[model samples]
Target: MGVGGIGIWQLLIILLIVVMLFGTKKLRNLGSDLGGALKGFKNAVKDDDSAKNDSTDENQPSENTDESSSETVDITAEKVAEKAEEE
Candidate 1:
């Protein structure tokens, strides 16, 4: 037989009943309200993500200590090698 014994005709009848109960105007308004609520929820989630990033940045130091020291050592070694090559 059909899906779960509910055929296409039965599904169409149910849809017709629902449309008759709510009417076209009410259904349109309901759809618009649902869309607006979803949009607002998405914006709120994005704002939360941006706020978290800002707070994390504020708590950490801008310059990492280890990286700066390693870079300075590399530059010193390069200069010493250059002077030896000139001799």
Candidate 2:
């Protein structure tokens, strides 16, 4: 089908209805409010980026472990197999 199944005539009709209902003055105020909201959102995003760049210590862990970690291996497969056979 067409995009949103709406023709140019249908869009024009909808626009006419909106203009009649809200009028030019209300539409102007709505446009200004939308512009201000978008500007505020952009400023908020920029502030977030600058805050992330400035505070490097906030991302780092405060404590470091002094103890050494060791790995151990066990070879008890044969014993486990014998126990399974007895069971």
Candidate 3:
């Protein structure tokens, strides 16, 4: 038995029929298109994961905070507001 009870000869015959219906060139083109689509999907997923990591990094407290000052500058908006009021 071949794949799920179908013999090897039967499989070959089916393959021949498929090749006859859709020539070799069309089959090659379809295979390449499918491969390209899969590659693109993989890249998109990787980019999405990296983007998520970047967003999380932005939300967390920065490690580069100035240790010399006791008061921590949480947001840059406060400094901007102060400067605007001074001006």
Q: TM-scores, in order shown?
A: 0.63, 0.61, 0.68
Weakest lDDT window of 10 consecutive positions for candidate 2: 65-74
- Model 1: lowest-lDDT 10 consecutive positions: 64-73
| Candidate 1 segments exceeding 4 Å error | 1-5, 64-87
| Candidate 2 clashing pairs, residues 3+ apart or interchain | none
Q: Count the backbone clashes (under 3 Å) in each candidate.
A: 0, 0, 0
Cα lDDT tens digits, model 2, 1-87, are 335998888888899999999999999999999999999999999999999887976788558644453334355987888899999
Give the C-alpha lDDT of model 2: 0.85
Q: In model 3, state the lDDT of residue 23.
A: 96
RMSD per model, one decimal:
9.9, 9.5, 8.8
Error of 1 at 47 (Å): 0.6
lDDT of 1 by residue, 1-87 (tens): 467999999989988999999998999999999999999999999999999999999999757577656664578889999999999
Q: After superposition, how far is residue 64 of candidate 1 from its true place, in Å?
A: 7.4
The models' CA-based lDDT, in order, is: 0.90, 0.85, 0.94
Residue 51, candidate 2: how far off, in angstroms?
A: 0.7
